[model samples]
Target chain A: MTLAAASHGFLSPTGVEIAFVLVGIATLGAALMTVGSRQLVHAALWLVVALGGIAVEYLLLTAEFIAWVQVLIYVGSVVVLLLFGLMLTKAPIGPSPDADSGNRWVALTVAGAAAAALVWVVVDAFRATWIDLDGAAQGSAEAAGRSLFRFWVLPFEALSVLLLAALVGAVALSRRGGGAKGAAETLAPAAREGRL
Target chain B: MHLAYPAVLAVLLFCTGLYGVLARRNAILVLMSVELMLNAVNLNLVAFDVWLRDTLHAGQALTLFTIAVAAAEIGIGLAIVLLVYRNRGSSDIDRLRDLAERPSGPDGAGSADAPRQPQPDTGAEATA
Candidate 1:
C-alpha cells in the first residue's frame, strides 16, 4: 500500500490552498484577540476561535479524527466550562483592572526567551529532514482508537488519573473556598452533615 | 515550500501568544494566551504529520490529546480564578499577589469580607 507521493499534486492541489490561507489568517487573528482581550470570558471565547483553527488545520492535514476531537473537547466542553466557572464565581465580569501589571516586562522576557529557544531547537533539528507531506493512513479513528487502547495504555491510564485529580482539586478548592483554615474544619463536617 | 507557510504561521501564533501571556496580567487572558501557544504547537504537529508521514499518525493524535487536555485545564483553571475573585473581590493578577503560593488564608479564615478595599464592578455583559 503506497502512500500518496509528496509532489503528486493530487492532494489539495487547487482552491483548497486559498481556503487554508484564509482559515489560518482568521485563526491567528482570533487567537490574538483572545489573548489581548481584557475580559476573562472574552478571552475564553477567543480561545474557541484559536482551537477551531487548530481543528481546521487537522482537517487540512487529513486527520479528521483529530480535528473532530479538537472541536468536541476544546471548543465545546472546555470553553463552556471556563465560562461557567467565570460566571459561577462572579469574576469581575468586565474589564480586568489588573490586565496590565508591573511584572509584565519580566513575563515578556521569560516567554520570549522560551519561544526563541524552542523555535531554534525545532528548526535546527528538522531543517534537513525529507518529509513526504502526505498524511499517514493509520490516523483514522479506528486505528487511532486501537493504538490508544493497546500500545499507549499506560499513558492513557495516567491521563485519566491526572484528569480526575484536577477535577477533584478544582471542586475542593472552589467549594471550600479554601475557607480560612483546615480542610477538616470545612469539608469533613460538611461531608458528615451531608452538605458537601 | 508549503511547510514554510505553516511554519511561519505557527511561529507567529507562538510569539503573539507569548506576548499576551507575559504582558497581560488578567488570568483569563493568560489562559487564552496559553491556548494560542497550544494552537501554534498543534499547527506544527499537523504540518509534520502531513510532511514526515509518521506511522500511527502520532503527531495528529497527540495534537488531539493536547487540545483535549487544554480544554480540561481551562475548566479547572477558570474555576479556581472565579473562586479567587469571590474571596478577594478582585481578579487582578497584581491584587492576587498576597494569595500567591498560599492556597488558604494565613489564619484559616477565608472570609469573603477581607479588610482590603473592593474595586468597583464593571457591569459589562459577562463574556460567557
Candidate 2:
C-alpha cells in the first residue's frame, strides 16, 4: 500500500481530497468557535456545525452509516443536551468576559505544543499512506449491521446495558433530595426530633 | 484520499478540544469541547476503517460504540453539572474548588475552606 501510494503526489489533488479539505476546514473552524465563543449557547450551536461537518467527512470517506449515526446522535441529541444544560445553569446570554479561565494562555500554549507534535508525527508516519475509497462503501449500514451482529453482538449488548446504567445514574443524580447526603439530611431532622 | 488529510484534521480538532477543555469556564462548554474531541476520534476511526477494509469492521463498530458512550457521558455529565449548579448557584468550573488545596497556614487553611463548605449545606437546607 505504501509503495504504490507513494506515486500519488501531493501536487495533483483528487476531487474527494478537495471536498475533504474544504469540509475539514469548516469543521475545524466551527470547532474553534465552539471552544472560543463567549456566549455559552453559541458554543453549543457551533458544536453542531463542527459535528455535522465531521459527518460530511465520514461520507466523503465512504462511511455512510457512521456519518448518519454521527448526525443523529451528535448533531441531534448531544448538542440539544448541551443547550439544555446551558439554560439550566443560567449561563449568561450576552457575552461574558469571564468565559475563558485565567489560565487560558497556559491552555493555548499546551494545546499548541501538542498539536504541533501530533501533526508532525502523524504526517511523518502516514505521508506515503493512502486510503482507497473506491469500489463498495466500507461502512454501509448493511455491512456494518452484518458485522456488528455476526462478530460484535456481545459488545453491542454490553453497550445497551451501559446506556441503561447511565440513564438510571443521571436520573438519580439530578433528582431533588436524591443524593445520600440529601436523604440523610431530610431524615436527620425527623430523627433528631424523635419523629422516627 | 491522502490518509494525512483526515489524520491531520483529527489532530487539529483534538487540540482545539483540548484547549476548550482547559480554558472554558462553563462546565457545559467544556462538555462541548469534549464532544469535539470525540468527533475527531470518530473521524479517524471511520477513515482507518475504510482504509483497512477489515472483515469484522472493527473500526466502524468501535465508532458506533464510542458514539453511544459519548451520549451516555453527556447525559451523566449534564446531570452532575446541574446538581452542582443547584448546590453552588453557579456552574463555573473554577468556582467549584472545594477540593482545592489551601496555600495558607493550617489555621488559615481551615478558615479558607470553611466558607466554601457551608454553601452546599445551606443549599441542602433550602431544598429540604
Candidate 3:
C-alpha cells in the first residue's frame, strides 16, 4: 500500500545525477566566491558553503561515510579555526583593499592553464570509467576501517603523531614573550627614567 | 555517471584556490585557499574511489587521513600567522618578506618589520 505512492518518488538515479550536477555548479560558485570576496569573513563563510557542497557531492557519489566525515572535520573544525585566526589576526570584517595583490592577472593566467591541463588529463584518463550508484561495495565505515587498519595503519598512526606535533608547535609559537623576564625588560626602561 | 563531471568540478575548485593563494595578500586568506585546494582533492578522491569500486575503499580512507592532517595543518598555520601578526603588526605577506628572507649584512638587521611607508591603522594595534 505504501509502496504504491512511492513509485513516483524523487530518489531515482537520474535524481541523484541531477543533484550531483547542481551541487557541483553551486560548489564551484561558492569556491569562486571564496577566492573573490575581499572581506576575510565573507571568504570564510564562502569556504563553508564550498566545503558543504563538496560533502553533498560525496553523498551523491554514494560515499556517505566520507561525506559525513567531511562535514564533521572541514565544516565543523577547520572553518572555526579559520575564524579564530581571522579574529586573532584582527582581519577587517569589511572589504579590504589589501586583500588582493597587484599580480592578479598573472595568477589568474597561471591558474587557468593549470585548471585546463588538470581537467583535460583527468577527463581523458577516466573517460571509460563508470561508477554504478547502487553497487554492493558502498564506501561505508566498515570498508574504510578495513583499509585503514589492514593497509594504512602505519600512515594513520604517523598522521596522529603529526597532529600531536602540530598541537605542540602551535602552543609554543603562540606562547611568545610572556614571562616575568619579558615584563621586567619592558619595565627596565621606564624604571631607569623613574616612571614605573 | 560520467566521471568527468566531478573531475571538472574539482579542477575548477582547485584552480580557484590556486588563484587565491597566489593573488591574496592576507595570510589567513591564503590558508583558506589552501583549504579550498584540499577540498578539491578530496572530491576527486571520493569520485575515483566510487569509480573503481574497490572493496577496501582506499581513496575514502586516505581522504579521512587527509582531512585530519589538514585540521592539524590549519591549527599550526594559524598559530604561526597569529605570531607573525603580533610581532609585525600586519598579516600581509608582502610585509613579511623580511621574516622569511634573512639579510646577511648588519645594516638590514634592525629593519625586519619596518614598513616602507606609513601603514594605516590596523585594529590589532590597540590589542597589542
The candidate maximizing DockQ is 2
lDDT of each: 0.65, 0.85, 0.79
Candidate 2 chain A has its poorest 10 consecutive residues by lDDT at A1-10
Candidate 1: misplaced stretches above 4 Å?
A: A1-14, A89-98, A102-138, A177-196, B99-128
| Clash-forming residue pairs, model 2 | none
| lDDT of candidate 2 over B26-97, digit per residue (tens) | 898888888888888988898888888899999999999999999999999999987776655668888777
Give the docking tier of candidate 1.
acceptable
TM-score pick, better of 2 and 3: 2
* Candidate 1 lDDT over residue span B1-128, tens digit each: 24544665687689878888778766766776777788788878877877776655677667766765776687678867765555444455765554445565756543542543232322211111
Error of 3 at B73 (Å): 0.4
User: Model 1 Cα RMSD, Å?
Assistant: 8.5
TM-score of each: 0.71, 0.89, 0.82
Whole-model alpha-carbon lDDT for candidate 3: 0.79
Q: Report per-candidate TM-score of chain A alone.
A: 0.67, 0.86, 0.80
DockQ of 1: 0.30
Write the residue-wise lDDT of candidate 1 on A135-163 in tens digits.
Answer: 35435788678767766667778777878
lDDT by residue (A108-176, candidate 3, tens digit) is 999999987887787667655557788554777777777889988999899989989999999998774
DockQ of each: 0.30, 0.56, 0.49
lDDT of 3 by residue, B1-128 (tens): 66667887888888999999999999999999999999888888888888888767778888998899999899889988876666556688976554464555555744633553234323334334
